[model samples]
Target: MSLANVFSIAGSGMSAQSIRLNATSSNIANAETVSSSIDETYRARYPVFAHAMNDAQEEGSLFEDQPKAVGAGVQVMGVVESQEALQARYDPNHPMANEEGYVYYPNVNVVEQMADMISASRSFQTNVDVLNTAKSMMQKVLTLGQ
Candidate 1:
């Protein structure tokens, strides 16, 4: 793979991490939200990611063999809501309680969402480091000709 591909891969990783962070934050924000109806309760959201690959021929191979598939970057397939059952609390006096004196809470777990946030933040930072390293390498290569 060419050095230029490093930038593309790192950028895609950053983008994917950003989406993950967003979803985690959203889940955390709605963790305590209550709904009178089960259908209206917010569900924890997670982002789906897939590896993007490209078929590239070797730059200077003499045999002209078949192209090899290489990892280009990560792509966000989509965000999906968790299917886990929502939290049903029996709070007869609560204003949002339904006729059955039950209020539906989001399925989001605060601790889990916090962990996901930390992971996504670290992944994003790692991608930033990769880009910086690639940039430094490219600069050094240019200086070699000076």
Candidate 2:
């Protein structure tokens, strides 16, 4: 792909990873939240992603083009809520306990959320590194022409 396209691809990747990291952090922060009923409990949130394609960069154009051509980067599909069941705990002294002395907690698993957070953070960092590398390569190419 062209040097300009490299920047676009890496920029989209970084944006998608940022959304993923934000969702993971949000899920972790609300993992321990308690509620009186299942409906009131927070559900784990996850960001979905899909590959984005742009037709404008199709090959076989009249002008010379990069051997490898990709129009854009990934796109975030959406944030989805997990359908896991809410956690229930028996605690008579709990302030939010129901009539049966049971409190409902979010379905979030701390261990899983922490792992997801780490993964997302790492992915984001990787994207940043890709952007940096692409930038440096582009700079070097520019210097070669000078």
Candidate 3:
């Protein structure tokens, strides 16, 4: 890919990582939230990404030659809620306790969320490095005649 395309690809990666960070942050924020009912509890949400591949397809199949199938970058497909069962706490005195003297907490795993945050942060940093390196490369290219 061209140095110019590097900028576009890195930018897209940065954007996708930003979305992932946001999702992780949201999940962390609601990790401890308690609810009286399952419907009211906050479910951990995650962002989905899809390869930004070109629409052109090979004859009779979605597959294409490597060069033609070069990914543009990535895009956030959507956010999906975790389907894991919620935690039920037997806190009879809690204000949000249900009729059965149980309060429902989100299924968010704090440790997992922390790991996700770290991964997203590193991915973002990597993309930033990519852009910076691309910029330096482009600058050097301009100096080839000097």
Candidate 4:
């Protein structure tokens, strides 16, 4: 791939990591929220990402004389809610408690969400590093002609 493509790829990666971080933060924030009904209970949310390829870069090009397939970047598929069972805590005196004196809490695991946040943060930093390195290399290449 060309040096220009490197920047686009790294930028996409950073965007994806940012989305992941947002989802992790949202899950963490709602971890302790309680609901009276199962339907109203918050579930852990996570971001899904998919590989994106440029249309013109297809092997059997739709357009004539096109180059080989090149990865464009990553795209966020969507946010997925965890299917894990919600916590049913018996709190008879709680305002949000159900008729059975049970309160529903989100399935979010704070520790896991924090770990995911750290991972996303590191991934974003790595992408930033990649962009910086690419920019430095490109600058050096320009100096070669001088």
Candidate of highest lDDT: 1
TM-score: model 4 vs. ground truth: 0.90
Report lDDT per candidate: 0.94, 0.83, 0.90, 0.92
Candidate 4 off by > 4 Å = 55-68
- Candidate 3 per-residue lDDT, tens place, 39-136, comes to 99999999999989764343443574443566789998999999999999999999999899999999999999999999999999999999999899
Total residue pair clashes for candidate 4 = 0
Q: Write the residue-wise lDDT of candidate 2 on 1-146 in tens digits.
A: 56778777888888988898888889889988898888888999988988887655445746765454445798999999999888899998999999999998888888997888788788878878888898898789889967
The C-alpha local distance difference test score for the whole of candidate 4 amounts to: 0.92
Stretches > 4 Å off in candidate 2:
56-71
Clashes of each: 0, 0, 0, 0
Q: What lDDT score goes with residue 94 in model 3?
A: 100
Q: Which regions in candidate 1 have their CA more than 4 angstroms from the true location?
A: 59-66
TM-score of each: 0.94, 0.86, 0.90, 0.90
Give the Å shift of residue 17 in candidate 2.
1.2
